[model samples]
Target: MDFSLSSEQREIQDLAYKFAKNEMIPVAHEYDEQGKFPTEIFKKAWELGLLNTCIPAEYGGSGFSAVDGVLICEALAYGCMGMNSSFMANDLALLPIVIGGNDAQKKKFLTPFTEEFKIASFCLTEPGNGSDAGGIKTTIKDGGDHWIINGEKMWITNAGYANLFVVYGTIDVNLKHKGISAIVVDPKSPGIEVGKKEDKMGHRASDTRGVRFNNVKVAKENMLGKPGEGWAIAMATLDHSRPLVASSALGGSQHALDLSIKYSKERNQFGVAIAKHQAVQFMIAEMGMKVACARLLVHKAAWMCDQGERNTEIASYAKAFASDSCMQITTDAVQIYGGYGYSREYPVEKLMRDAKLLQIYEGTSQIQRLVMARELLK
Candidate 1:
């Protein structure tokens, strides 16, 4: 198989890397400390066509391939995943439109954001259910000509900042997965309330909150696909998003290895550079290997998506393996620094914090394992 990137892909990667280093890196720490969203950075990204990379060209987007999406995500994540997530959440929010939205729905919801540069979000998790997603208790009751939604979504990324939301709720509680329905909601709707942003352990810069829908009236026309299609829609969205999550993890691991190697080369111990010590050399070597392997998985999944192949199994493998490797590599980076690694002054501590959410969100490491196994056995 040809693994080399096309010229277009290479150019996009270089642009993303340059933008992250020049624009994002300088402000990453400040935003992390303040737990604030960087509107200016997002606006710049939107201006650069970085924010709406996955939307179709006819819909006023760059129409980048899936591999291009992963490449851009990796570079942006190299600077900061918290900020990267704030940007990448657009991908999750727009997935339903790309996957199943009718032309009018796409034109009205997807096109405006791509052209006007507004943020979007996907709402799936609720306080009672995340990995057991089918347990979501959010309910949508039919009203004459409109659907009145009354439910609360928890840990919603981009909740406060998003202009549009692709939300899912159950239309019939007795039907289990078959009762689920997906719809688009405007944030300014009369009954929509976004709670205070949650104080998170990591990815603090990304907006997270509880969103309450209180008798919010949405036209039946806003519904995506047919009722009872939410499960299928949700799965399709994850198929595209999982690889992007893996790419973010891969970037964090790459940053950790780079920092560890640089420090080992310069730090002196027992009258010699730490890099000269076999133990230190071994640690870096192991971390490097993990990063390389994880990257391969990420790229392979992205390539599969570009080929128009259904990549559920490979996507699960990449997400599970890359997230686990990132956590290990970042932790090793901290261990290599001895006491200094634990200090907030060092970048490894930040890497450790950022690597954690990779395992928790998008689907936990355990959930990914289950998905991979189920697909493999079938």
Candidate 2:
């Protein structure tokens, strides 16, 4: 099989890389240190069509394919995963709409962001449920022309910064998975509260918080797909996004390896550069090999989805393996730096901290395993 990127894909990746290097790299450390939300940079990125990309061209978006989206994600993430994730918050928010929203719903909600920089958030995880969608306790009740929603969402990215949210909750608990429903909520609506921002372990620049709906009213027309289709919509959304998450992890891993290799060559030990040491050389080699494999899987998964193929299994595998590689590579980069690695004076420690959320956010490594097992067993 051919493994080269098409000219269009290469252009997308190079443009994204240049944009990230020029814009995000300068502010990555400051944002991480201050845990500040880089709103201005986000707006700049939006102007470049870097945010909310999944929205179709008919809705004023650039109309990028899944492969293009993943390529952009990887390029941005290579500069800094935290910044890339903050920018990618738009994709997580809009993927469900692109995958399942009716034409009217898409036009109303997805079109506005393409005109200017605006962040959107996806609300799925609740206080009690992280990976289990069926455990969602949020409820939406029919109210004639509207629906009254009551529940809380935790660990939501871009919560405070997002103007729109794609929210999931239950309409009928007795129906279990079929009882779930997805709706779009205006973050500014009355009774819709954006909780305090989380002081996370990493990805500090990405605004994450709890969102509460206390009988918030949503137009019935904003319901995504049909009632009882929330679970399916959520799963389908992940089928598209897991590859991007894998790309994020792979980017962090690549940066870690690069940093380590450069340091190993320049730092001398026993009157010779540490690069001559067999152990350090072996570690760098393993990291490079894993990063390459993960990058390929990430691209393959996105390409499969763009081709309209069933890639549930491949997506899970890519995310699981790539995220694991991120964790491992960052850890090894720290080892290569020894004392300096564990300190804030060097970038590896920050990379290690940033790499961690990659495993937890989109789906835990264990959850990915479950997805893979289910698909394989079937």
Worst 10 residues of 2 by lDDT: 44-53
Cα lDDT over the full model 2: 0.89
Off by over 4 Å in 1: none
What value does the lDDT take at residue 377 in candidate 2? 92
Deviation of model 2 at 46, angstroms:
1.4
**Candidate 2 Cα misplacement greater than 4 A, ranges:** none
Candidate 2 TM-score, C-alpha based:
0.98
| Displacement of the residue 177 alpha carbon in candidate 2, Å | 0.7
Model 1 over residues 1-378: C-alpha lDDT tens digits? 787999988999999889989998888888998998988998898888777677888888788888899999988998888898889899899988788799998889888887686888899999888998888788888898998888999888899999999899999878889888899998899999999999988888999999999999999998899988888999888999999999999888888899899998888999999889999899999999998888899999988888989999999999999999999999999988988999987778888998999999999999999998899889
- The C-alpha lDDT values of all candidates are 0.89, 0.89
